[model samples]
Target: MPTIVHTIRRGWVYSPFTCEYCGHEDQGAIHMKVGASAQVGILQDYDDTRDLAMGTAHGNMEQAGDELIALSPCPACGKRDELAVKSFYAKAKPWIGSGALFLVVGLAGAGYLASEGEPEMGLLATSPLLLIGLVVLIAGLGKRLRKLPPSAVFRSRNPEPWAHLGPERASQ
Candidate 1:
């Protein structure tokens, strides 16, 4: 019997960003420290767990950064600007196109093979393509229906100072 062990590791990610409203850049940048856990196993499941952990940490950092920017107004302008976040349609376009192509090619090939009395072979070869195309198409469409929050928003209830104010401004 194989024994599986789980391990947790802590790490930090440094993200440098510019203020969209005032063009102010952070010299020291923001430090996002997070922890991720992974399972040790003899199979591919270990890799998947590791990947998931890392992705979770990174995603948390990104969300934190976005919220920070949204809540804190530019020190120079005292106002916030819109952040540019990729939309669902933009991210799903490639997958959707690829799925459609796969479906079309698979269907065409299957039809041609049927005319030649090799329909069974054609389906055996193209079945994988059709299945993959259907799965990808459904996934892409599901993503298209997801509603993502706006890239930036002004939070008047509890405003905070910008993370990195320049040296001259810091002293004042």
Candidate 2:
């Protein structure tokens, strides 16, 4: 029986960002690790595992680093800004506007049909659209109203690192 060997790759992404509130510059880092396994005797398979692990580590590091930079507080001020929360609501504004439009149209159409003496038909035709619009509108509003306190921001032990890994310097 061939023994299986596991290979692991580790990587980190570092980003330089300015504090939204205090205008202080800082560096943020996110670390990631990935592993893959292959039979001990298969050299080619081991190489494939290394490739897989490196790729996974790279992708994860990038995504995690972005999130960290966005949500982490400034090391100098120890406070987080509302930029991320504001951006989130800005992105949802279009969806909320569309949902409101759909809801109004559905209601008007249903009312018009009912006035023409086809109440049941009108309700049956517009019910699905009305329901979908209501759901989307509520969800968008809920997200917009969600609050993020200062404590909610990520507080890393070492938000500013002296040295970090860059994309070109990633090790396999």
Q: Each candidate's lDDT (Cα)? A: 0.60, 0.66
Question: What TM-score number comes out for model 1?
Answer: 0.48
Best by TM-score: 2
* lDDT (C-alpha) at residue 111 in model 2: 96
Residue-by-residue lDDT tens digits, candidate 1, 136-166: 9888888777765333322222122332455
TM-score of each: 0.48, 0.58
Any runs in candidate 1 off by more than 4 Å, and if so which? 1-60, 67-88, 150-157, 160-172
Residue 46 Cα positional deviation in candidate 1, in Å, after optimal superposition: 18
Each model's number of backbone clashes? Answer: 0, 0
